[model samples]
Target: MTFMKLKFGTAVLLGSLLIGACPALAEAVLHRGNSGEPQTLDPSQTSLEIEAFILKDLYEGLTSYDAAGRIVPGAAESWTVSDDGTVYTFKIHDKANWSDGTPVLAEDFVFSMRRVEDPKTAAGYANILYPIKNAEKVNKGELPVDQLGIKAIDAKTLEITLERPTPFFVELLAHQTALPVNKASFEKNGADFIKPGKLVSNGAFELAEHVQNDHLTAVKNPDYWDAANVKLDKVIFYPSEDQAAAVRRFEAGELQLVYNFSADQIERLRASHGDEVRVTAALSTYFYSFDTRIEPFKDVRVRRALSMAIDRDFLSKEIYSGAQLPAYSLIPLGIATYGEPARPDFADWSQLDREDKAIELMKEAGYGEGGKPLNIEIRYNTNPNHERVAIAVADMWKKTFGANVTLLQNDISAHYAYLKEGGKFNAARAGWTADYADAENFLAINLKKNPVFNYGRYDNPEYDALVEKSYNEKDPAARSKIMHEAEAIVLRDQPIAPMMNFGQLWLVSKKVKGWQDNGSNDHLSKYLSVEE
Candidate 1:
């Protein structure tokens, strides 16, 4: 959350402005600065928030979120769940079609689901589909892809059977991973399917152009089923991780909306522009994951010491300008489903007391107090704020226990890839925004069998059992209790140091109407219109 002092390059801003200043569009064209480069355009492979911003517009899943963040029908007109609640039957909207006017059939969804389950696809988010019967087995190569419990009854009818009754299955459908992909386009284009003029999507907007780190443009899809309600003619996104650059582009009148304003500039912007500066307690947490399989971190004392040494209050106040909360658990405080947030074991300890305990624990682990110093490398994605936080945390560890901490910064995509696959870093930056408004979304990532998001490689059979049991437990109160137990175990082990809960800090032009602030931090252009 810490913002570093970085100058916005005038040349880069001008180049971006030139690309977005489309005079041909007489009515409405939205200019936005995406928070970071999209990790991937392929729906099944994408995991980053920046990618979700574009993917949600370019592809329509069975369900979608309205401007209010309420679940609504998208590709499916309606769906019915069986008495057992393990089977779902969806009635596809007859008018839904690809940007090219080809009918979007139920078969398309089946193909996409199967592809995600196929081991050959190597989709990072394929585990999201594990609720479906045989999906986990298919992903592990024990079962064939054809065994996945999704089938197209006909061109307009689709049915799916789950391993158990999943209360959040409907919400899961709204996620990009559940969206359909054109099988023909997939085979024909291979890796180039999402490129300009090569993509075929069934959403309000279709891919018009994409240039790696520079920009991604989407034009209104004429063949979209509900094109009449779509207000924007074109939306241009400039991918950037620099908060200063985003703020600069927004002030220059080149961008209508921007993400992650510098902490220092927020107060100035609020005083000058007032309501234009939007800040909401987002359902997300900014944290760090430890490589639990590695040495030093393998010891519970070392992990707990590191977690206790850093001051969460300092991070929320001094660094983020009090824009976020001091998080003590995986699930953010606002989530009512979890009842109450679980306080970490060190929550009650004063800063001095925590520092004393951290020193003692480091000694017990045979590290500090004239013993061998604990050498740890902290890796994070390239962002001014991320770098600032890393520097602060490293300093805290050095001061508290005389530990040697090295900060390694990589490109956003590369950073995540290294954490998930490279397995070389001691600790890495991590964040989780609720995919659905449930604690399960945050807690499920730590499951030992979940190959997708568990970058830390934390394994506890007892903890995993509690989480797995919560899925099938029908009683809301019972589920919450089980989840709490699982969270307590995680806090005790300290696989991740819960840093700070997120408050989305962004700027939206006052001229933009119908922009609703929601916990999801969703600002889909379909619901917005420009006054000019």
Candidate 2:
């Protein structure tokens, strides 16, 4: 109902243009600024937040987030959980229809569930569906794709069996990874199903054009289930990785919304645009993952020393201008269900004392000047903010540990590809935005089971066992406790050094309406309108 209430009073927009003796209405358009060029528009193939922002516009999942980031019914009109909480049944909305005028069926979701879990699909976040019975085994190639616990009970009814009692299953369903891909379109076009003419979306909008680095455009879908309530006629998403350029464009009135601008420009942007500038705490974490599969980093003392020596507080206050908060644990604070995640023992220590201890630890671990020279490379994506953060961290290591550090920069797409494809590296920058509200979503990244997300290749049998135990625990309180223990273990080992919890920054034009700040940071185009 929250989503229902967010809709504009009238779905239709009217703009008068005197055409000789008659008046014509202009098409309602929204110019949106996204972070970077998407690697792919395929929901299953994308791992970036920027891609998700657009995908949510083109695809509808069983559940979706509203303008306020609250979960709401989406493609599935209604769903019910079994008494045991291991099975879910969803009734597809009768009005749900793909862009091509085909009725959205339960079988569509069933096919998507199987494909995403199959080894052939190569979905980056395939592990997100691990809750489904035999889902993990199917993804791991131990089970057939047909073994994934999803079935079309009827044309409009879908049934899913879970491996265990998953409390966040509904929340996870709203993630972009869970969105259904039309089987007919995929089979017909092969990998090109995402092309403008081929992509058959079941959301409020459908892809109209994609101009790579320029912009991707989507026009309203007449066949959308709630088309009558959908206001925007078209939405243009610009890949604005260059924040300065994006800011200039926004100031020039070329864009109504810009995402991820330079944090240092906050004051000036706010001064110039007044209340148009926006900042909201994100349920996300930015960190550097160590290649634990390699030497030096394999040693806990060396890893801990490197992590402890870095002054996170300084980076948050100086580099990001308070746009982020110093993080000690990989999981961000204030996640629902799980409260106050465990932190490193050195978390409360003064920076001066921590640095001294770090030096001693490095020397003891056969690193630093007296021992082996710690030659390390810091890999990060090509963004001004990332470059500055990498340089600051590299400088800290050079000064404190007397280690030689090298920095490697790649574009957003290539940077993630290198890590996800299991490319060998020293230390690489990584950030995770929550796919759902669960702490397990964050902890699952470090699991040995998730190689794509677990770029560090951190394998701890005890930690993995604890996580598995939590999955089958059934009781919420007990599961939380077990997860806390597992997190404590990971923090102690420190395979990934927590840098900061993110605060998403954006610039919204005054012409834009229905923009609301949310912790999850999802502001769907369907809930927004623009006034000319």
Candidate 3:
């Protein structure tokens, strides 16, 4: 891994002392509980906490989502769409440059997009670019990678021709998979650039230092296009896995911000600093998926019985302490096109009358209540909150369906390993955050042959057809109707049980100002001001 060491001398010592003495003059330290270690810093290959955290500091896309979740220009100053909507021409910003002062040209975008789609990269969202001409064929190795649609007209112009007119193309570019990278920097660092200090960035901040499992420090980028508006001089992120430890760090004045606090800690914090605690209902849903290819769970009735056995409202109120809202559908509220209105909720499945129905369904699936009880193991990460939720779910299943259930908890890394290998867990809990502001972002995961993000390995040709049609449909209302039908098919199958919608809680210190915790769930410390 690449590591940079500062010269050890009195100058460094004096700087440290000054930083410690004046909180406003020093970097703002933000503490958070990440469930797992970052697999890699390569924007194309990594997802989870690392991708979510690093994208804010180390990358810039042609377009970006603003605090209001609207598409805004980043490296690109302006763009034009053809009358037919198949051609997109972007005018690169004259001032954008890498941290090494190299000009960010249109070729960089082409290189980055092609690199993600390369078979060697294994990027999770590579299919996201399939709308671009030849992207799918190139990804499937049917066409050469060079044949991909993206091209550079010159140093300052990028022209993208698509096979179909994509209405959310600009919003999709804001995702990390589409972020530009410097070819020279990437080639020079080779595989080592994924580590700290070796990477080059043109975003609001640049990585200064990183200590494994301890902290990551980012300093403001002086060369950023919006440097004048960036308020923070530096940001320190502590990746503590313990929620209570994060709360203690915040209470001890070591951290200016904390998120994802435990239920008990949130209650205590609300009792004390209620005014400082901010809560926003997220467009995220936590759910459990069954590997239908596996035995027993292969039965649709058994899956529906398991779904009916769990009480979402009870879980939200008791385990989550009302911090979450019960989720009846995969798409959360506030998502524009695929919000709650676009999907059919399970009205017949209810906490009140669902338990007896669950027993009957399980019996019909060849496991009679009080007879040969169906034994199953449910798995989740080893976080305290996750364990508590899993245990509660296990108890609910046992009581309602009269089936024996076991709770299995592993560290985040081990759990992900089990998922990748398609281990024998009957069910597993997972969550997905949006990549862009579209219903397609949520619905695309169910595409029949998609290798990434479809961990359930769900294959439904009808759903896939509807998704493809919706992608090219320019009329919002017409597309939404098709998407609604697709959502109905998925819900009816019950391959996954939608649990709850997240209500993210962030504690910000009084010294921090001008920060808006937007719906995208990104924390851009550069937009925060330390009180003078």
lDDT of each: 0.87, 0.91, 0.76
Error of 1 at 30 (Å): 0.6
| Sort order, lDDT high to low | 2, 1, 3
- How would you encode candidate 3's per-residue C-alpha lDDT over 1-532 as one tens digit per residue? 1233344555689888988897667554444334345556677865565445666567888987666555789899999999998899999989998887778889999999999878777677787787789888888888888999999999989999898888878877887778876788789988887667788888888888878777777788888878888877777777656777877777777777776677645677888887667777777878898877776787888888888778888888887788888886877778766556433344455576777777888888887565566888888976677778888888888777666788887766667666755565688987767777677777876666664556667777888898888876878889888888887887777777888888876777666676576777766565566663
**Every model's TM-score:** 0.94, 0.95, 0.91
| Residue range with the least summed lDDT across 10 consecutive positions in model 2 | 8-17
Residue-wise lDDT of candidate 1 within 383-433, one digit each (tens)? Answer: 877887899999999888888899889888888877777365698998999
Per-residue lDDT for 1-532 in model 2, tens only? Answer: 7666555423322212243334224578999999889999887888899989999999999999999999999999899999998999999999999999999999999999898988988898898899999998999899999989999999999999998888889988999899999999999999999998999999999999999899899999999999998889999999998888998999999999999888888888888889999889998999999999898999999999999999999999988889999999988887879999999999999999999999989989998988988999999998888889999999999999888999999889899998999998889999998888888988999999789999989999999999888888877888899999999999999999999999989899999998999998888999998887
Every model's Cα RMSD, please? 9.7, 5.9, 6.1
User: Which candidate order results from sorting by TM-score in descending order?
Assistant: 2, 1, 3
What TM-score would you give candidate 2 relative to the actual structure? 0.95
**TM-score winner, 1 or 3:** 1
**Model 1 stretches astray by more than 4 angstroms:** 1-27
